[model samples]
Structures are given as structure tokens and as C-alpha cells.
Target: MSVETVGIIGIAALFALMAFRTPVAFAMLLVGFFGTWILGGFRSSGAVLITETYGAVSNYSLVVVPMFILLGNIASAAGFSRSLYDAAYAWVGGFRGGLASASVIGCAAFSAVSGSSVATAVTIGKVALPEMKRLGYSASLSTGSIAAGGTLGFLIPPSTGFALYAVLTEESIGRLFMAGILPGILMMGLFMAAISIVTWLDPKAGPHGDHVRFLQKLKLLGKAAPLLAVMVLSIGGIYVGAFTPVEASGIGAALVILIALAMRALTLSAFYEALLDTVKTTAMLFTIVIGANVLNPFLAMTHIPETLGTALTTLGLGPYGSLAVIILAYVALGMFLDGLSMLVVTIPIVFPIIKAAGFDPIWFGVVAVIVIEMGMITPPVGLNVFVVKGVAEDVPMSAIFRGVMPFLMAMIIGLLLIIAFPQIALLIPNSMFG
Candidate 1:
């Protein structure tokens, strides 16, 4: 059979396996292994899978993933997220829909450390939902804000999304992290605006929270200062050339642990749990990486990426038009696939077309992540919405989905802004790394 035909069959088999609820990693591994064996020999496919697994696991740069994840897990166990919510609440909680806005800010602050959207939603939801409920906020608005804010975990600096994209595309982790900074802030602002509009349309949806004295606000801010400091040091250190992304992760992890210990919030048992969770999460990430690596070679043998890129170029669609199609595909796939799986599965095929079109990979990484974040809130398979629902059990799942709609629109607008002005993503990375 022709190589293209083999590639098409392989892709079909892949989707079929996924349809049956096969783990994405194992599905890719099985398809990639057998496909490579068919195109090459068993010997070459065996070598490829073994080598890819080893390479993915032993890569030095990847240490950043677990280290950053550990920092987030430790921070969560130690109550740092609550302090962040408190600080945001002290400042913004008194306005109409202020509690929900504070939840967005709090989510952003925690995401700066957590780097996982699900974790961000769950952590902030546990803290923010009750307060919003007490303040008479609507379930839709309250749950909606937390779910939407959680997406920041994937867009903000130290994002796992950026880190994994860097691994797949050979982009600089530091530059990708920098690229996300401005866009993350812009997204957060847009979410806040969504809350403002939601509350304005129905004041009953979000009532005023408690007013705090200036001294009280400062005190709450002081309580959360350690988290802010850790964020600045880890992410800022990269921009200023003080540390590599990996080093920054290590430092951030150590700093958060020490802060937790100093506050008497981290027990020996909690530390152990943090380590365990980090290992589990890290192992999951590595499995996906290795699967992608194995599958990438099989794909190369089939020449699918090259053929697809050539086909797209022949279509005479300009760069922006081509980009629109890709983004639309992601939105469709996101209805069923998790962000990480969607990313790993598609990058092998998509990255080549993007590069051929002369688009910047780093900027594309930011754009890709924002779209993935949108998927996390999109319905039928809205991962973040499900996560928030789990935490706010009293709030119906439908309400959470309804609440996330405005934020989803805001995300689309932010994405368009970034598309029209790539510099929003490129400015910091170009200035710092040049």
C-alpha cells in the first residue's frame, strides 16, 4: 500500500482506539509501534520506542515539569491558595460581582504557581465558591468565574502547556514562558470584564461583598506576599538571565516549601504527599511525551506531515486563513480530547505546516495554549467545568457551563487580539532573548 494510505489507516485506528476509551498514551504507543514496524522493520520500531522512552525520561530540561508541579502541590497543601484568595477578596470583594472577580484574580495568582488548569479550578473553587455563595452570588456566576479563571493555569507563566509545547516543538521554554506573560494578563483582564458585564446585566447575579479597611487590605496582601515573591523570582529570574527555567523551578519549589514550613502549615506527612503527587503527575506527563516521540517517528516514515503541509500550501490559503482552520480544528477536537492529548496528537501534524508558513513557533505556542484553555471550558467535554462542578456540588453542572459562556467569549476576543497583534506574545520573548 502507499505511504499516505498507510498513514490514513493508522490515523483511523488511532481514533477508533480513543473512541473505546483507550488511554491516549497507550493508544498512541500501540499505533505508532505497529505502524513503524509495518513501514520499517520490527528491529527499527523496537529501537525507536525504547530510545524515545529513555530520551523523554532522561532529558534534563523536563525536570522543570515535576519541580514546578511539586511547588503547586506543596503550596496547595500548605494553604497558600487561600491566602491568595483572601488578598484578592480584600481588594475587590466589595464591588458587585467582586467576589467572582476576586476568584478570577485568585485563580490567576495560584496558576502562576500551579501550572495545571484542573488544579487551579479545584483549588480556587474550594476556597472561592463558599464565599460567593455566602455573599448571595448566583451559582452560574460563581461557578462560572472559577472555571474560567482556572484556564489561566495553562496560559500564565510556568505553564505546563508552554513547557510541554517547548518539549515538542524545540522552542525555548524560557521564551515560551515569557511569551505567555502579557497574553495571560490580557486574558485575566478580559475575564474580569466579562464578570463586570454579567453583574451589570443582573445585579442580583453578583451582590457586593464585605468592605475592608485599608489596613485590613494591606494585611491580607502581606499574608499573600510570599506567593507573589515566589512567582516573581521563578518567572522573573528567567527574563533577567538570573536562572534557567529548570533552575527557576527548583528554586521556586524550595522557596514554597520553606515558606510553608515557616508558617507551620506544612507537616512532614503533607510534604511526603506533595512528593507523591508530583511523581504521579510527572510520570503521566512523561508517558505522553514518550508516546508522542514514538508516534512522531512513525509519522515521519509515512510522510504525513510533509504531505499535509504541502497540501495546505497548495490550497492558496494565506497564513491567517490557514491559522483559522487549525484553530477551528482544535475547538472541535477539544470537545472530546483533553488539552494535553490534543496538543501531543496534533503538534506533529500541525507544527510543520505552521513553520512552512513562516509563522513564529513561540507565538504559535501561546496561541495554541489559549485555544486549549478555551477547550477546557467548552461544553460536552469541558474539563474545567467538570472540575468546578465536582467542587461546587450544590451548583448544577448546567449552571457552571452557562456561567463559563461569557468567559469563553472573552477568551475568543483575547485570542483574536493576539492573532491581529502577534507582538503581544512576541514582545517580551524577543526583547529578553535577543
Candidate 2:
């Protein structure tokens, strides 16, 4: 077989392995290693694999991953999730679909501190789902809001996805983090608007509740102050150039540890568990990244991505039309794979096409993250829905999926807005760093 044909077969086999339930890292590693061996002799391929693995994992920028994950773990262990939900519920719970809106607000705040979508979904779901059920909110709206909102984990500052994208693409991590801010806020706004419209049109979906006194609401705010402070210190520091992305991650991790200690939420056992979870999650992410390093070079050698890029450019689709196709592809893939897996699997091919079409890499990163966020709320393999279902076991998985439909619509609209006006994602980064 020609080298290019071999690359194509290897790619197909990798997807087959993933579809058969092989772990993503293993799938990539298996295909990458064998593809390398096929393209070059065993000796050269083995040497290249070893060097690439070490080089990918040993980079200084990669350290940010564990630090950010550790920070998120500490924040989750610190009881910040409850505080955020309580504060949001106190202020927003009186209106129609108020609890659902509150869930989105809480998820956004939690995303600032916890950068993993699953962590955001599980943590906030534990706090918000029962309350939503108690208030008679529709299963779909409550579950969907949390599922969709959890995606903010990657769109807000301290985002793990952004950090990974920055390292992979050699973009500035600080600039990428800055770029996400406005788009994240816009997403939150769109979600809130969606909830309001849904409840207004069908009040049965979310019944209104008695208002909390202003004093009670203010007291709830006090509980959330520590987390709010952490968000400002970490994100604000990065925005103002007080610290680089790595430095901010370290500082944020330290600050979260301190907050957890002060809140008396971090017992020795909890702290140990947080550390172990961070280690496990970080290990998984790094493993896939190293595998991608090997696989991407092999794909580059085949010129598959370049050839695909040329074909798309020649299809007479303008840049916008081409971007629409990429976003649609993400939506379809989202149903079948986890967000990170989708990112690792496709970015090697799709990113070059995006850049070739003259889109900014940082801007495209934000767009990609938003698209993946929609996937988190999508059906079949929606990670956020599963997380919420795990927490609210009484709510059927089917109901949870149904509940997220409007939020999914909201996400689609937000994605469209970002794509239509690149400045939605670029304004903050350009203002702060340009």
C-alpha cells in the first residue's frame, strides 16, 4: 500500500478501536506506534516514538495541566460548589425557571475555579439537581442546564482545554485564556436568556418560588466570597499580566488549598483523595497528548491533512462555509466520543484547515471549545448528562438528555454568534495583549 493509504487505514482502525470501547489513549498509542513502524523501519520508528514521548511530556508548558487540575480538585474539595450554588439560588431562585438559571450561573462561577467539565458537572450537579427536583423544575431543563453549563469549564479562564490547545498549537496560553472571557460571558447570557424564554412560554416547566429576603441573599454571597476572590486573583492576574498562565495556575492551586484548609473542608483523607484524582486525570490527559505527538507527525508525513485542506479550499466554499462544515463535523462526532478524545483525534487534521482558511488559531480554539461544550450536553455520550444522571439517579438518563435540548439550542446560537463575529472571542485578548 502507498504510505498515504496506510495512514488512512491506520486512522480508520484507530476509530474502530475507539468505537469498540478501547480507551482513547490506548487507541492512539496503538495506531501511532504501528503507523510509525509501517512508514519507517522498526528501528527508526521505535527511536522516534521514545524521543517524541519524552519530549511531549517533558515540556515546561505542560506542567500547567497538573497544576490547573490540582487547583480544580482542591476547589471542588473545598465546598466551593455548594457556596456558588447557594449564592446563585438565593439571588435568582424566585423567578420562573429560576433554579435552572441559577444552575447555569453557579456552573459558570464554578467553572472559573474548576476547569474540568466532568468535575463541574458532578460537583454542581450534586448541589443543584436535588434542589431543582424539589422545586418541581422539569427534568430536562434542570439536567440540561447543568449539562450545558458545565461546558463553561473549558470556555472560562483556567480552562484545561485552552491550556492544552495553547501548548499543542504553540499559541500564547495567556492570550488564549484572555480570549475566552468575553465568549464565556456571552454563552452564560445566552443560556440564561434561553431558560427565561422557555419558562415564560411554558411556566409548567419551571414553577416560580417565594423570594428570599435581601439580607438572606447577601449572607449567601458571603459564603461564596472565597471562591470569588480566587477567581479574581487567578483570572484577573492573568488578564492584567501580573502573572503568566503557568504562574497563575500555581498561585491559584496554592490559594485553593489555603481556602480549603480555612473552610475546614480539607481533611487529610479529602486532601489525599484530591491529589490522587488530580494525578489520575492529569496522567490520562498527558498520555493522549503524547500519543497525539506521535500520530500527528505520521499524519503530516502522509500529507493527508494538507491534501484534505486543499480539497476543501478548492470546493468553492468561502471561509465561512468551510468553518460551518467543521463545526457540523464536531457536532456529529460529539455524539460518539468524549470531548477531549474528539479534540485530540481531529485537531491534528482540522486545525491546519482552519488556519489555511485564514482564521486565527486562538479564535478557532475558542470556537472549537464552544462546539465541544455543546457536545457535552448532546446525546448518547454526553459526559455532562451522564454526570448529572449519576448525581440525580432518580432522574432518568433519557429525561436528562431531553432536558438539555433548549440549552443545546442556546449553545448553538452562542456558537453561531462567535463564528459570525470573531471579535466575540478575540476582543479581550487583543485589548489585553495586543
Candidate 3:
């Protein structure tokens, strides 16, 4: 059989494996391995799998993943995440739907360090949900805000989503990191706006939080300052070229550890748990990377990406029209696949089409991340929604999905604005690099 025909069959097998509930990593690895064996000799396929596994695990840039994950886990264990939320609440809690706004702001701040939506949602949801409930905030507004806001973890700097995107596309991680800043801020503001509208339409849905004195606010900010400082030192250092991503990540992790120990907030048991959690999360991410690497070569040999790119360019839809189709495809896939799996599996196919159509790759990275973020709140397979449900066990899952709808609308608006003005994603990166 021809190699291209084998590639087509491999693609079919991939979807079949996924449909049968095989883990995405193993599915990709299996398809890539056996397809290559079928096309080439057994020896070559074995060599590909072994070498790619080692290379993915040992990659220097990927060290940023674990360090950042460790930094976030330690902060959560140490109660810094609570401090961050408290600070936001102190300042914003008095406004209508203020606690929900604070939840979003809290998620964005935490995203600067954590970089995982599940972690962001869990940490903030654990702290925010009960308080919102006590303050009489509606379940939909309370849970929805955090579920949507947690998505900031994927769009903000030090994001695992962006890190994996960089690895897949060979884009500059630093540039992508910088690129995400304004868009992240934009999305956060939009989320807050959605909160305002929700409460404005139905005042009782989110009652005003207790008024915090200016002195108390100052004290809360003081408690939150250490995290802000660490974020500035690490993410800020990358922006100024004062450190590589690896250096920034290492420094961030070490700083968080020292701060936690110095503050006496982290017990040895908690620290041990943080380390173990980091290791498990890091291992899962690494496996996904390895699987993608294994699968990519088989796909390349089949020339599927090239063929898809050619087909896209010849469609005469024009660039923006074509982009709409790609975005739609992402939205559809988001309902079924988790964000990371969607990113790794699809970028190899969509990226070439994007490049051929003349969009800036870094800008597209921001666009792709934003669209995937929406999926975190999108129903049927809304990962963040499920994560939030774990924290608010009493809230019906349907209510959680209902709650995210406003924020989901907010995401669409934010995405449209970014598309209309690409500089929202590119401004910082261009200014810093140029």
C-alpha cells in the first residue's frame, strides 16, 4: 500500500482509538508507532519512539513546565493563593458582583504563576465559592466566573498551553509569553464586565460583599505583595531579557519555596504533597509531548499537513474567511477534546494552513490559546466546569454550565476584538523584542 494511504488509515485508527476512550497520549503513540512500522521497518519505528521519548523528556525549555508547576503547587499549599484572593476581595468586594470580579482577578493573578486551568479553578474556587455562596451570589454567577476565569491560566504567561504550543510549532516561548500579556488582561477585564452585567440585570444574584476598610485593604495587599514580587521578578525578568525562561522558572520556584518556608505557612507534609503533585502533573504533560512527537513524524511522512495546507489555500475563502473556519473547527473540537490534547493533535495540521495564509504565527498562538480557553468553559467536556463542581459539590452541573454562558459570551467578544485588532496580542512582544 502507498504511504499516503497508510497515513489515511492511521488517521482513521487514531480517531477510532480516541472514540473507544483510549487515553490521547497512548492513542497517538500507538498510531504513530504501528503506522511507522507498517510504512518503514520495525527497527526504524522502534528507534523513533525511543529517541523521541528521551528528547521530549530531556528538553531544556520544558524545565520551565515543572518549575512553574512546582511554584504554583507550593503557593496553593502555602496559602498564598488565598492571600491573593483575599487581597482582591478586600479591594473589590464592595461593588456589585464584586466578589465574582475578585474571583476573576484572583484567577488572573494566580495564572501568572500556576499556568494550569484546573489548578487555577481549584485554588480559587475552593476559596471563592463558599464565600460567594454565603454572600448570596447565585450559583451560576459564582461558579461560572471562576470556571471562565480559570481559563486565564492557559492564556497568561508561563502557561503550559503556550509552552506546549511553542514546543510543537518551534515558536519562541518568550515571545509567545510576552504576547499573551495584554490579551490576558483584556480577557480578565471582559470577565469582570460580564460580572457587572449579570448583577446589574438581577441585583440579588450577586449582592455586594461586606465593605472592607482601606486599612484592611492595605494589609491584605501587603500579604499579597510577595507573590506579586515573585511574579514580577520571574515573568518580568523574561520580558526584559534579564533571564531565560529556564532561569526565570528556576528562580520563581526557589523564591516561592523560600517565601513559603520563611512565612511558616508550608508544613513539611504540605511541601511533600506539593512536590508529589508537581511530579505527577509534570509526568502526564511529558507523556503527552512524547506522544505528539511520535505521531508527528508519521503524519509528516504521510504529507497530510502539506496536503491539508494546500487544500485550505485553494479554497478561495480568503484569509479571514479561512480563519473563521479554523476557529469554528477549534470550537467544535473543544466540546469533545480537552484543551491540551486538542492543541497538540491539531496544531500540526492547522499551523501550516495559518502560515500559508499569512497570519503572524505568534499572533495566531494567542488566538489559538484564547479559543481553547473558551473550550474550558464550553459544555459537554468543560474541564474547568467539572473541576469547579468538585469544589462546589452541591451545585448542579447544569447550573455550572448555565453560569459559564455569560462568560463564554464574554470570551467570544474578547476573541472578536483580538481578531479585529491583532496588536492586543502582539503589542508587548513587538515593543520588547524590537
lDDT of each: 0.93, 0.87, 0.94
**By how many angstroms RMSD does model 2 differ from the true structure?**
1.3
lDDT string for model 1 (295-410, tens) is 99988889999998888778898888889889999999999999999999999999999998899999999999999999999978999999998998888888899999999999
Error of 3 at 346 (Å): 0.5
Q: Which ten residues in a row have the lowest lDDT in candidate 2?
A: 293-302
Once fitted onto the true fold, the runs of candidate 1 whose alpha carbons sit more than 4 angstroms away are: none
Deviation (Å) of 395 in candidate 1: 1.7
lDDT of 2 by residue, 1-434 (tens): 88879888988998999989999888888888888888887886788789989988998887778988898888778777798899999998998988888888998998887788888888888888888878888888888888888889878887888887876788888888888899989999999999999898889888886599999999999988987998899889988889887888889899889878876888898899999999999999999888888787778877888888888889989898888899899999999898888888899989899999999999999999988888888878898888888888888898888878888888888888888899989998898988
Q: Which ten residues in a row have the lowest lDDT in candidate 1?
A: 308-317
Q: Report RMSD for candidate 1.
A: 0.8
Error of 3 at 403 (Å): 0.5
- What's the CA error at residue 202 for candidate 1, in Å? 0.4
Which candidate would rank higher by TM-score, 2 or 3? 3
For residues 198-237, could you state the per-residue lDDT of candidate 3 as single tens digits? 9999999999999999999999999999999999999899
